[model samples]
Target: MLEGVFMSFGAIAASYFTLAGGGGSSQYANAVLADNPLAFYQFDETSGTTMADSSGNGNDGIYSAGVTVGSYAITTGPGRSAGFSNDIGGTTDYRATVPYGSWMNTNELTVAFTCFLEPMGYFRLLASRYGEPGTDWSWFVYGASGTLRFHWRSSGGTNTNIDTGFTPVRGTKYYVAAYVNASESGIRVYDATGLVGQATGAGGTVNSSSRPLTLMNAATGNYTANGHLDDVVVLGSALSTARLDTLAGIALTPQPKWINRTAGVSARNGTTSHAVSFIPTSAGSLLVAVISTPAASSAVTAGWTKRVAAHGTYTECAVYTRSASAGDATIQLSVSISNVPLHYTVYEFPVGSSWHSSVSVMDDNVYPVLTGLPGSSPVTVFACVSDRRLLADTAGESVAWRYFWRTELSQETLYGGGTDGIFTGIGVIDEVYDTAVDVDAMDSHVETNGSGSPNRVVFAINVA
Candidate 1:
């Protein structure tokens, strides 16, 4: 009997947690993806003027020749950020232009950038638009004043200014942003610290831009900033100071997927402790292993705690769990006997998930009756169990399994299956769920058949 909150019957993770394109770890992309931006430019290019939009929205951008950039190189920020130097020769000949499709003509729009500047001693435009004289909006740190400003020209030819009192300095990296919405105030400007300035007169948005939206200059060469920019994103809706902070200092690193596609989510078998091979990327990640050894008692590794231990067909089955550390490449454990076949499935719980409870079945129960859950919020319950040999549902809690997937391996042979059995085997059955269903829709237990041989390893994870 352990002291804990909720109860769980499973754990799962794989491509389900995959971040943006493979070029960067989803660690950072995941956060950015949460906001659902229309176009996200990581500036991960070397020679070509093409700026790949990582948002998957296909709103790619083209850079000007004056801007010299390279593949991702900077790493001192959020994730992996490409580094580049802007040399827009004091002219209106350099800028990054992105398509302003009909979807962009929104009343609510936000544009943000994280950049490091080299003293330019002149006007520097961060982002803006170029069109008819009466229809233009631009934000820049004006020369001399060095104040961050947000301005917009409404389609009605009305001009408004939102002077974000905060000033940016040369030789310093800063996260700068501007928000404009006709439904709200004038315009809001922000720095990494927070909302520095806003007003109530700017009532225009992307609708005023005739050409593509431009960065580092007003789509022309005017006031082009000389610096490195990253985390450049454009949103379809306006965001408050709290929500807009998410874009600050976001980094992007192109690396191999945390877990590859081929063999990360399935089951593996071995005769030794060092059975599974996985390289976790950070701390606080939950690593779980469910081991079933044929007629042998398996032991948990040094750093892992056994969550549930049960027996079936004289076979030892247990669930081992451990949080991630700095370096946990290949997990190792041992059993009483070396020659016995040990079948196990290793799963990395979704990132940022908290464990609830885990249970293994010795009788007819596959999961526990979840009640008295402590939180007002909902949690994810995941489960997997080999039911090749499940005892009869004489326990009354027995119900049909509704959310499980069949596996290819035959790990549990019911005792009544006419083999080296202690009870009557039921049939060859494997079940698990990789995705989520309504939490209340889960059953308390499962039934094979009355008087049927029941023996298997089952486990679940509840994450809040």
Candidate 2:
């Protein structure tokens, strides 16, 4: 016979018990899918049964929240024990009290929990804030301390008690639930095995006087008791035993969705400087840009710009690899967005000279309003290298209109004969002469000894 006030599952495997006054291991007493998240705790004092005494270290005690934390403590008589046992042939005394707060209404109520003791002893769960002391509006106590029987007292001098020989377990999870439903008679008791006691009809009467429920330490007096408890659930609804067990069995993981998507991918390919665009193409979301140079004289500088298009020809977005050192440099590709979720796929052949910047656009976010050419949106990417110059496209037709692109590079008059203009030659082409290199972002200040040197960067736009 477990001889404690409550039984606690000590392992950290998601499920727990609240011996004395705690909400098991999850720290949440309630669990509701919609707006209800469990919130309850168990606490105990060094020696007393009051809330203040049991409030452990940190002043918040075992059952404390940011603002609304309560104190709880466990107490026992000389012959009491708070551990597991195979049989409950001995008598065990236990008590718990909420020093503060009022259980004024049915919206928030407190349920009772107890196990068997050779099928004898009184088990009372009451709420008392005012009026006639223990006989106030809060008169819900199950008197099952001696025989397998249950009794209830309500306001307006109403009372009812029933007898059911409940075969309680010696060491197990048991519950005595009370709530304000169409019939407040759902009061039930259970052992580790199954339901040991239940009322035949609605057994609880409602009182019009609104007073929070508070437990008296002893039914004979207005004080509280110090008892051990475990596995307490303060939920919005009374979950069935099967559902509760299922929840206790399942494990939960806590990570958002987006973090799983952008975890692994090279930053040095797909035309952007170390930044790959998840571009939706006729084929799929593929890496479609290269952002490095392959010759000493010709360096591939990559940059990207976004603009909200009230009216435009086609959807456009781009990513670039940070600039690389001159000669035999190209950002390589490793994976393609195939068999994955994408917004839309459109057809656009790669165009423009490898030296001249051009944008091969694709649809992202697939908004219905973006079906025409007028719907454009913008997003920002970082600069791989500052001081690298950019030149406007020589293709002056409306098809060559470059959108307003911004770079993080500081705007200073070029010194050291460094003019801010395009240095072309490392033009992208379908032919051979292959050499691709992935240059990681080289912090300009770090590589240049605090001397800001020009680094290769890419800035491109779609020219339809």
Candidate 3:
């Protein structure tokens, strides 16, 4: 591939389950429940306030007046399912509570739910057992931002969060789940499309044993869900990726992740060079690079293959990649050049992944977008502009996306006696992405440097 190679490119309620229509309950016979969830509440009740636990463990939930028991909504499951509609501020705020018990397992845990999100501009509580900051467990969608936030800690603040790169909306019905396996140090998350995100995990937490499992809204009354909740589940142990995929009702091949990235400092043709360094991100990770230059030079390190490039009139950009052997070995990038090869950056993609698709050009792009993305892979864009006083940023940024480095090249006066800049980044978009929903727009800079309208070479890469 010459010009383009790579390129390019929740929440929920408490824990409840509804199998469309009257007979929908049978769907729970799925392998998900085989893991023996601590308490499984199948909300089949269209009357009274009781949401029964069918896991043979009997931990039931009661509803508040604000909850309409027999409401309806369509789901990824069969039939038109029965749901619980929280009248945002109708009478009382929506609330559901299941008695707390020894079910709290801080070592490994899982929580799953299906909900209809509304466009309210507040916090929509999903499941909460939060009391104090250090030991609290809060999972919900910030109604204002629609970001699915998860907080799982061991004690004090020694924990972190897992982010599902995609955001949810009102029109779609989604099945969401979070699995925390402290032993594996993995927190896998699923939405309508199987395992969408995963992070180094956090252990579960043993509650005060006094707080009831809050569904839809927190006990402190600080936050409440503003939509409909159809199915929710809690497991004492983390569910495997296959089981979690089954729960989401979607078949997705978990894609590779963007592990690490490195960029060198500014250099003039005869003056400077950078020795960029990065260790193998994983046992079998692959390292790749995009070199932008005015012309070909012997500036590249050995053992790297040029995967793709766009040779423009004034400048050009190329992609180079190499396999990383399993282990803690570090790869080095040393360079020597004459006029241009303006900059180069190295990156590591998840093990067993390869170049999928991309888009690139050796010219100025005021409005650039990366399309033809592989459904479940991550994409990263890199750009090098002639003007050094540059600012690199994403046109459509989000929680799932990450920026690696934005370096300013102050010494170069190549091609146009101009300063230069470069910015490159990626996303854990390795989720089963709905390309129709996610945008891959790339921009060179927010504003031009005071001295130039320089040309630039921009490219996007996808790894699967």
Candidate 2, residue 443: CA error in Å?
69
lDDT tens digits by residue: candidate 3, 109-166? 6787655555544555666665433344533333345556565555444555555544
TM-score, candidate number 3: 0.44
- Global CA lDDT of candidate 1, please? 0.47
lDDT string, candidate 2, 1-464, tens digits? 21111222110111111234322222122332221323232332323333332112221212212111221211111111121111000111223333323222333333443322222244533323333444544434434543333344454456545555554433233454443323453455653344556653343444434443333223233322122243333443445544433333221111110101111223222232232233222221112232211111212233321111111121112232221222312232222221111111111222321122322212211111111111121111122221222232232111010001111122221111211221111111111111211112111111221122233332222221
C-alpha lDDT values of all predictions: 0.47, 0.27, 0.47
Error of 3 at 242 (Å): 2.9
Can you give the TM-score per candidate against the true fold?
A: 0.44, 0.32, 0.44
lDDT of 2 at 410: 23
Greater TM-score among 2 and 3 belongs to 3
lDDT at 189, model 2: 60
Candidate 2 Cα lDDT to native:
0.27
Which parts of model 1 are misplaced by more than 4 Å?
1-23, 71-90, 118-123, 131-144, 186-206, 249-464
Q: Which RMSD values do the candidates have, in order?
A: 20.8, 25.4, 14.6
Where's the lowest-lDDT run of ten residues in candidate 3? Answer: 1-10
Ranking by TM-score: 1, 3, 2
Which ranges in model 3 have alpha carbons more than 4 Å from their true place?
1-24, 76-92, 120-122, 132-144, 184-209, 250-464
